[model samples]
Target: MTLMTFVYLIAGLILLVAGAEVLVRGAAKLAAQFGIPPLIIGLTVVAFGTSAPETAVSVQAALDGKGDLAIGNVVGSNIANVLFILGLTALIAPLIVSRQLIRLDVPIMIGASLLTMGLAWDGSLSKLDGAVLFGGILTYTAFLIVSSRKDKAAAEDDEFTKELGLDETPKPYGWVINAALVLGGLVLLVAGSNFLVEGAVNLARALGLSELVIGLTVVAIGTSLPELATSVMAAIRGERDIAVGNIVGSNIFNLLCVLGLASLVSPLPIQIAANALAFDFPVMIAVAVACLPIFFSGFRINRWEGLLFVVYYVAYTVYLVLFSTGKPVAEVFAAAMLGYVLPLTAVTLVVVAGRAWHKHGFTGDELKR
Candidate 1:
């Protein structure tokens, strides 16, 4: 590839990061000014702002008729958000799983993912399918907002207070300044996504790789950098709720908002690649379902669990590279993972979840801290 190609990728990444940072900061402040709970802000405003790059890039790719790139971007991003970003954040500090996430948001996320799979079963996403997905996001957001009102006790949590600076005095004209920042961030995201998509398509052609592979591996990770940064920083600051919530929220947003909008804007239905339907979609769904047992195990992600996540992410990425390059070892690796690692992990998680349930004597209404 030419030097200019690499330049585009690097420049695009820098802009995406800068844009997401600005957008999240402004949006969080704006939400706080309205007296929104910090967890709600993390799940909605911060999540949507950090996800702007995926929205921009996927929509741009759809308009260009590169449907695979668009689809791969959303799927890959969801995968990375959980496996890479959340894993890394937990490694930094074991994350506390908010009960709201387990009882509400995580289940919503799983449902959204299953809905995407069902919609894509026809191999194309029509405008009607887009409507269904987009509608889900609106409903989910409204539910979170309404439900948050009953959970004012969450506002008293140390992490929420520290994260949102709930006691700090608001500056005059804060809303106006925050609005400007949001707009400026949007402009940068649009520009950056354009560059990133163009560079990715060209690089795919040069390397004899499919646009889908490039989108899944390189572009997916690149676009998800914002979520990575937000989660890692939150974890470092001990804002455990925001750290975990951001990843889960962004995954839901990616599927519902990014993919739905892209499908709607496409002149024709976006095609779902056969491999993606058979493999990637199932993998994404498995990852989402896996969260239940892990999070239920004492309502926190331990460092050991975090390391497991990181290892799985690494193995997943390596498999993608090998498979894309037609390496014989790819099959062996897949077989090993399916035959041994996955089953072992599943059994281990079941035991952990059961032990936690028994130890806490959890009823339908209560979970011990």
Candidate 2:
């Protein structure tokens, strides 16, 4: 890459980090002002804010006719969020899962992942598919709002009121300041995304890499910076729910909101390159499935488990690089996946299911309640 390109890339990253900080702070302030429940704000407004970068990049890529880049970025990012970001955050400290996340958000994330896979099954995501995905987003948002209202009402009851010290009537400034923060944060998000996308595309060309590769690696990671920053901050602050929620919510948004919207703007035709179909997508699914164990077992992800995630992520990246460069890395990855990773994942799932059954019984009726 040219010196100027490197400069832009670095500058873009700085902007992304700064923008995310501003966005999160602004969002939190707004949430507090509006008397929104912490969980609601974290899952919806804050989650969307942190995912703004990914959305912007994907949309821009689609508009620029690099639909694969757009789609790849979102898919790659979801994988990174689960395996890399969450894993690293947990390595720093074990993340505690809120009941809401374990019961609601995690399942939603898995559903979104499966939905994305299904939509792309025909080797393309058309405008119609986008409409379906976007519709789901709207439905999900509506559900959250309704649920938050119920939660808020519940919190206002005698026992909850005493415990949380909630005020029945919020101050007048609540709505106004929240509006300003959301607007300003969105402005910064748009600006930062532009810079990052421009720099990333240029860098890819300089390195003689396909836009798809760039999207899957550099752009993916760059767009995911917001999640990394937010999750790490939440972990450090001991806001375990926020850390875990941010990762899960962002992944869902990446799959549904970002990719879906991009596809609507421009239909993304999947390139069934053997490597992508065989390795990349499966790796993404593997990462998603990997979380089942970490989450279901005590509904917690501890530090050691997090370290294992990071190791796997590093190994994944190395394998990608080698495969892309036409190196003989397939055998290594195949051996690892077949011999160790796949079996371990299967075993973990079985154990988690058995534990859940033992604790909650065979029927899921208790879980529903």
Q: What TM-score would every model get versus the actual structure? A: 0.90, 0.81
Using TM-score, give the best candidate's number. 1
- Candidate 2 steric clashes: 0
Candidate 1, overall lDDT?
Answer: 0.86
Model 2 lDDT tens row, 326-357: 67866788688679986886786668756865
- How do the residues 215-246 of candidate 1 rate in per-residue lDDT, one tens digit apiece? 98799999998888888988988787788888
State in Å the error of residue 97, model 2: 2.4
Candidate 1 residue-wise lDDT at 38: 74
**After aligning candidate 1 to the native by TM-score, how far in Å is the CA of 165 from where it should be?**
8.1
Question: Candidate 1 has which clashing residue pairs, if any?
Answer: none
